[model samples]
Target: MRPTDIETLVQVGRPTIAPDGAFAIFATSRPSIEANRSLSRLWRVDLPAGSPRPLTRGSGDRAPQLSPSGDVVGFLRPDTDGRTQLFVVEASGGEPVQVTDRALGVMSFAWAPDGGSLVFVSPVGERGRYGDVDGLGPDAESPRRITGIRWHANGAGYIVDRPTHLFVVDTPDLDAEPLVSPAPAVRPEGAPAPTARVVPNEARALTSGELSYGSPVFAADGHGLFALVSEIERDRADLRSRVVEVSLDAAGASERVVVDRDANLTVDDLIVTPAGDLALLASSVGDSGTDFVAACIGLHVRRDGAWIPLTDPETIDLGDPGSHVTALADGSFLAQSRTRGRVQLIRVTADGAIEVLRDDVEVTGHAATRDGATIVAAVADVTSFGELELVRFSGEGVGRRITALGRTPIAAIPSEREVAGRDGYPVHGWVAVPEGEGPFPVILQIHGGPYAHYGVHLFDETQVLVAAGYAVVYANPRGSAGYGRAHGRSIRHRMGTVDFADVIDFLDAAIEADSRLDGSRVGVMGGSYGGYLTAWTIAHDHRFAAAIVERGFLDPVSFAGTSDIGSFFGDEYVGVDPVEIEAQSPMAAVSLVRTPTLVVHSELDFRCPLEQATRYYTALKRQGVDAEMLVFPGENHELTRAGSPRHRVERFEAVL
Candidate 1:
């Protein structure tokens, strides 16, 4: 595939099935190289089996949730003002009506159990913090005071001032007609001032505080909500949220904590089952409140005021998107589980018996029925991009692919390889070779998230390099996720030690196993933690002919202050000691590097920060080694994945 093929690629968001399983609607988005923004539209499938049709035009539509009776679909879309407001359209079809007009915009929302009203989480702060209350723009806004560590996010700008709160919006009758303009003139007799029977499109705050709230799910009674609450103002640290019961009444603002926060726990998501049981996905934070290195996210079910742990945290690491659970008819729940690079469905019974449903294909997004008869998921194997597949809960094969919209056909099949570390641990990876290759020069790519794993999917990085007459080898060595907590924590304090060994061991094993890979012409490259490892590899091995380090966490000391999660990220992964931190950093070994290197960075990348790539590139140049730096403006660490279409293609070109 060519670099421009990035635009041809399509992504499917989580599918939402109607309560009765009559149809399914999901959002499909693709990056537009020319527009330089993600384009999205909602598509609906008349269920059991039917052709998918466009449901709503694109305004970056997202989170399409069906109303109680499944007649209207409520989703978030940017209003004319460019703030994400709630919109609803008849499931059958029609122009979506804007149902909400909030200044700060909706972050997440849930329909009331009765469907008459919906609760959304939106930022509530004094006017002008977001924009002036008057017609003036941002330049007329008031000054802000500095506060909090979690004040801003990587891609999102300063957000500490606008703490999110619960807001309930009563839905206007779908059949209601447009109101007459300016209202009729009042008669001399004053017939109720000629009032218009118009339903308000405004929302009322349900709860108010400096704390931030999100993932609102209405309580079964419909008079309350269960929202994930983060004590950001109370504790300025890595967001640790707890589940609470939020009352809708004015006198009910006093929240009853359902699931209290624990130093060992960080809530990921929360949802109510058909029986009103609250199920949550959370990961262990250890005692440090930030021991976040490759922590496993497990499932928890709260029934009748008693919360029960469903999966063992150390052994079961549910994929991030997989945490969304669909309650089945048999008192069991269906959620996604990640193991060995493949994310598949797993059934968790109320009693905590875990059963793997499918393991052959990785499920990127999914929706299931209450009866467990039908399940729709975005599935991708080694050679294909994600395609919507309809599968039975108790399926035998890949049930059936329902939509051909997101499929990206592969030109060459990927070969999976596993190797043992020198200390006798397993390392996994994949090798993609070009069609006409004798002994192709190899590009050894490493993934970020020492905790994130490489999986069987249409990874463009490997596909693009292989198309350019270079064999691409990438792997999930030690410190990668989907391999249980032990494998992830194995490299916590030993950053570039065994993890580096596993990467090298896997590369060597791949060369020995595949005849098409040229071991002598090897080039190493990685981003984030992978970038750190890449620099360390060149400095320590001196065998690589070239290296490309993008967004590497080179200097731990500097990272501890600049990175968004740097406050505790370094203390957990590396060490708190000044000497030990330096010793473990890749920057310490940069003087030994002799390989030609290309340092790629995004100007707005706050995760690794721009200084990371710049520092590595400067060190290489000073040492008299060939080096070059490429920086993309208005981009972040997610440049390779979510950057502009043109920039992504340019990155591929630079890699070549």
Candidate 2:
């Protein structure tokens, strides 16, 4: 496990079981150095035997799904036009046939229950009242009208004129060649075949208007689709989302509101069960200190005709950071969530009982069989990379791993340790020591999210650091997810004060417990929120030898005005007022830093933005402090983790 071997690792995702439960298909991505990009391909594994092989070739192939009939598998791939179009191949073996040839590309798609067609969402240019598209194209260069605060995203870029909408395409007829093309059709001078003139069952738009749809899901009976839509006014302080039911048969039809937006709740990730019951993940939307930025699973039973909150808002979290849900045959739902420091699967019973199904490993992707008898998940811990694991559930909410699919051998594992925060709250962390060492130089890495948590997962950055002969220390402090709501909410409105103290306390505990860590030769580094802590730590304390700050907010005032989520990030996380945010900003004391700092930033990172790094570096240099800056062009905030393998390795080399 050398630092350069990071490029050779195969990252697996979306382990979906086939309809018949004969095998499983998943998305695997690895770096292609020749192309200078990551190639994601689909792979299949025999169910009981767990023998693995490639199912699709080339790059940009992802989101593979075995059709309901179990004869064909559907996936998304980029065509010659660079637009992601639907493609399907025989379940046994054959060449894949291209389906839709849309210009903007399909963002997401789901197969119908009856296996007739697929409902997909793709970006469409904004249209006038008369339904004429305003001038927008794949190569059009024009000024985009700026009207909304959340108009541009970090990775997605400016989304002003183009918005995503829902459409349906027949998958069966997609294999046949079209009857007409630019080359001209063989028809008599005056006689023309009407239906034959156009491709049969052409893609139809089921949704329209100035709105955006996310992850549309088909109903169990295939009558309609349920999806989260952003129809509320964008100028509002907080963006609102609600679930809408779209009719598959009607064009430009009125959609029914399945779940209306509540004053304090943001609902998303809608899933429908075989019983027709709707389940959604909802989080509290507010600037209150106890606001639940992380959502919990909510259930809406059709029989009762009302939505009921399944998990406790203040006590239970969704185990994971994002909103995700999977419905079962018996009307129960499974979601990835964290309890203390490990992300696991939790089952929300049909009767409203919350139980932890598996709690030892970090489950990233999971899918269940139609009958809910077996489950397959992509799991990993501190010791290994993500691999497909067979999971079985029994009575009383207990689960066990049956087998590992394509498991990668690990060289070393981190030792878990518990330390008390300055306020006496328990903080969990892991320390990775080198093979032969005494008082080794240590690198303390803090995780971002201030809302996100670091679990027992195999973090590449940690592994690479350890491979470079440096002991790495990572932890889940206060404000991290998986330890319940109070633990996360504790850092809200407090920011650098509480979490900073927790990090210092954990470092002291680590130094006292282990004799191999060199307490005097320590380097600090972090990204996003962790970046904020690093800047703050070096400013307040002078013990660090070097510091690395990657895409972190140095000034809350500038961030509140420039960041895409700036309007609400500081107000909700730090405080409701601008004054409170300014007081807690790391920039307030950045001039006090005297350590050699290396600043890493992505040019296109709209979340933290490049100005954050530039302003801090300029300040540090002006103070005559030893400092350097590394800026990655055309990259976003995720550069440290999901960026190019070349850049990731270069970042580690610079850190060392």
Candidate 3:
């Protein structure tokens, strides 16, 4: 693997099964180096065992949703103005007709249970803002009067100025031109124009106000909908969200239900069972807004108008916030669960019974037939980058591979292992060793989310280093997801103690386990949380000869005001105590570092912000320690994963 290999990687996700469980459709994306962006398209595959074929031209298509009746598939694609809009196409095959022409891009959309109409979430700002008209950008807009803590975000700036609201679009009217123009140029005089089924454009907002709403699912009768609502306040400086049910009747609607009562709850994924029970992944931000700081997300179900805990809040992690969850026909729920290092599909009943349907596969996104018989999942592993895997409970064995999106770029599979921590606790991790007889230079890499873990997957970063003749070792320490709650919450207020020791323990054990690893020439490198650990490692123990800290959260003091999630991140992850925060910060102990360091950061990274890298690098240089700084303009904390193709290549080269 090389830096240029980033362009060849293809990612597929959001698999949805058909009503009869005979076919499925999923989205595929590949980065175009020439265009410096990722191009996405939808693909359909016959279930059980079948070849995958392109359904839509690979042109910005994403988030495909299969309608209730399975007569059509609704997806989001860019309009003429590059704003994402709702689109629908025949289940058999044909051109997709645009269903909306929202001023701003559509965030997400779902079909009504009865399949008569669809509901979408979009920013309902005041007219003239966010390109509402033909030609208007932020430069032409007036200043904003900020009153919320979530006024600005990392990638999407000034979110509070135009709160996102929900609107309903019905398809009653089918022979007219599309609500939004087609992506390509207008047809010639003799050519035909696509017709959208009968329906007016967006009628009106079903919801409005300061709070933002998302993850909406329609009721079985299509008379109401359930959505997650976020409420931000000024005093506590934390984000609090809950689930609510709203009457779908635009006029004379007066009923609303607040589903969850836990304060400081961050709702991740929400699903409504066929029995109408609610299952969601959420974590309560304990009293100090830091109680469950580093713990994995827990699963909860609504019973008798009260939220009931289903999965163990500490140990069982049900993927990330936006991970997909399907409600089965028998009242059982299907979801991708994170355990140890693998994300496997699990079946959870209304009474809290869990049965693993698929194991040893990293389930990224999944959808199951309401019967819980046929399951289609997007999986990634050591040998495969990303592809679709099918699993059938009605069959005798695990389901077969359903799609091969692209060629696999990984040259060798990483060896997984578990080593003992300093305190005798077992630490799980993996190592990718280059093909050679002699000892290779080592790179001990750390993962970003102290909560995020290194799993069995084709990671471009480690692959490139190993291909360049370096041994890369990474581990999921005490503060990582997968393992149970005790492991994830072990490092809440103590960032660099046992967690740091667990990482060091893994690195040392890997070097000792394999003779190919050179302990003397070891260097440390990581991004975000990994970056902080890299700086912290060098500051305390100068075992490494060099270091690269990219977008590290160095000082919690300044991070409270600068980061997009700064309102409660610093106080929640680190501590509110000034002394403990400073003592644990990598920047405060910069004087002890002697390793030659290279500090990397994204200029617009609101997560860690550029100040973290600047402060650490400047302090190292001021103290006469060797240090260098490299900053990428217009990039955020997701630079490595979603940055421009050329910028991604440059970042890999920097690591090399």
| lDDT of each candidate versus the true structure | 0.80, 0.76, 0.80
Candidate 1: where are CA atoms >4 Å away?
A: 133-143, 179-200, 233-239, 250-252, 302-307, 393-398, 406-409
Task: Say which prediction, candidate 2 or candidate 3, comes out ahead on lDDT.
Answer: 3
Against the true structure, what is every candidate's RMSD? 3.1, 3.8, 4.0
Lowest summed lDDT across 10 adjacent residues in model 2 is found at 394-403
Q: After superposition, how far is residue 450 of candidate 3 from its true place, in Å?
A: 0.7
TM-scores of the models, in the order given? 0.93, 0.91, 0.94
lDDT of 1 by residue, 239-354 (tens): 45578898888665668988775535688887777877677887767565676777788887765565556888788888455457777767888888888888988888878888
Cα shift from native, residue 499, model 3 (Å): 1.5
After superposition, the stretches of candidate 3 with alpha carbons farther than 4 Å from their true spots are 132-137, 172-200, 252-255, 260-264, 287-290, 393-395
Per-candidate count of clashing residue pairs (backbone under 3 Å) = 1, 3, 11
Report the C-alpha lDDT of model 3 over 1-656, residue by residue, as the tens digit: 88898776888877887888888999988777888888898888887777888889847998888888776889989888788888888766787777777777788988888888888899877767876676778788877876667667887766776778778888533455545444556678998877643235555678887877888888777888889877656655654466788788767444475665454566776777787766777766665554556555667776666665687675678855346678887877777788767888888876778989877867888887778777888888777778888777354456678776547567557898998787789999999988877599999999988888888868888889888999999999988888887887788778888888988999999999999899999999999999989889999988898999999988888888888878777776777898889877888888899999999999988888899888888999999988889999989888998898889988888777
How many clashes in candidate 3?
A: 11
lDDT of residue 454 for candidate 3: 84
Cα error of candidate 3 at position 636, Å: 1.2
Clashing pairs in 2: 319-337, 319-338, 320-337
Looking at model 3, which ten-residue stretch has the lowest summed lDDT?
172-181
lDDT of each residue in 371-467, candidate 2, tens digit only: 6666777776765556777676322222433334323334458888888877788888888887785778998899998878777877777777777
